[model samples]
Target: MTAETQLPQATGSCCSPGGACHDGADATTGGVTAVYRVTGMTCGHCEGAVAEELSGIEGVSSVKAVASTGQVTVVSEAPLPEEAVRAAVDEAGYAFAGRA
Candidate 1:
């Protein structure tokens, strides 16, 4: 018999199933939108942690993390350095897989 691993369902209006929180569009006015690949995110909590850490960086306007897709979208006033982004992801207990 094979044991199947099940992931916990994400709650909240944004992370919930079939939620259309982000359309994956670059809609930042006078800002830069960067999509980065992240690993070790398996639930909403992980998403929140990553977003929080990234959001703490200076010039960061907003951050959205989708655990299911292992993608993090960041909107900032200017282009951020890869080292900065990587440090933020590492602080969140995740691996930064670079730009997506």
Candidate 2:
């Protein structure tokens, strides 16, 4: 018998690493979606780091970071304060370029 190679299945969510996923709707609580520009992200690792830091904020439902475009899409229960977002991005060792 010949051996066959198998690969992991895709979840089909836009949350994949280093890619842009705009679900258009919040994943939880029907929250609002906000997009912000960021700097210094050059790879999936950068995206993950930014996402992680932003995800830690209160009221955040979901986050998607795209390194190529230097933009992050965030879903939250309401509009988040600019300073809060900036601080989170800074915590991840990147610069927040404001809303996109």
The global C-alpha lDDT for each of the candidates, from Candidate 1 onward, is 0.74, 0.75
Give the TM-score of each candidate.
0.73, 0.72
Encode model 2's per-residue lDDT on 1-100: one tens digit a residue: 1111112223333453433335544433356668899999998888888988998889886787888888898877777999999999999999999999
Candidate that scores best on lDDT: 2
The alpha-carbon root-mean-square deviation between model 1 and the true structure, to one decimal in Å, is: 9.6
Candidate 1, residue 13: the lDDT equals 44
In candidate 1, what are the lDDT values of residues 1-100, reduced to their tens digit?
Answer: 1111122223334332433235432332345668899999998888888988998888886787988889887877778999999999999999999999
Q: What is the lDDT, from 0 to 100, of the residue 44 in candidate 2?
A: 85
CA RMSD of all predictions? 9.6, 9.7
